[model samples]
Target: MQGSNWPIEPIPNEHDVYFRVHKNYIVNDGPYMFKPRAFVERGDKADQHKSMSTNWEEYSTPEQTQSEAKIPMDNGVVAMSVGGLRSENLTVNHAPIPTIRAHTDVNGLPDDIKDVEVRVKLFKHCRWVINPELSTNP
Candidate 1:
């Protein structure tokens, strides 16, 4: 309910892209090889670094999200198009931080079956933006 109070903003263009960071463990074989769980947020684990939130590419660049946002350098970034997600019935809203929320609801909660389907679509559509294994910083 944190974003519920925030003013609703314009959604990113369909052609626009967003970024998601994945830890080393999320990588199956290489940086390009990603696990579906990477796109799914688990309620059991807290995102202490993100303040229990996820940031989209519209608000920040992949490098900034990792460096400026204080995410670990060892993590890799995956890029997905706004249109692709929308096609899957997922909503991309820019509520100050630019978040990916469920199309049916506004809170962006990720515990339901719809969220699971969305995660799978994200996994299928995403491509490597920054390969952790090839990154000089990593």
Candidate 2:
């Protein structure tokens, strides 16, 4: 809670919360809502092996993440706890912004199907922390 704008060396604690900006990551149907691909890397050279960017809740407020960090707020934010992600064998690491990475097994190979499973688990553990439609005009 007392850090600078950028993420620091210490990994967030299990009880700590983080937020994922859901600009184009969400799906809305009739009465259902979910993230289509919440934690996948964007395949950009800069984000090749890292999960999508997330803000450490203790270090940043949702408003700051959206405004100061310049993360889009088209949909909203998904609040995820460190412990919750660990349950799915994922590790939350600190980059410029905190990122979620899957824990590799002995083989150290990336499995596409397993990645999908992890994304689903992450989606289930998340809850909306902001609603742009009601909280922002544009």
Measured by TM-score, the strongest candidate is: 2
Off by over 4 Å in 2: 1-7, 12-17, 20-31, 38-48, 68-73, 97-114, 134-138
**Residue 82's lDDT in candidate 1:** 64
TM-score of each: 0.59, 0.61
Over the stretch 26-118, how does candidate 2's per-residue lDDT look in tens digits? 565544455555554432445335454566665565555555434564546556776667666776655542232321111111445246666
Q: Top lDDT: which candidate number?
A: 2
TM value for model 1: 0.59
Candidate 2 has a TM-score of 0.61
CA RMSD (A), model 1: 6.9
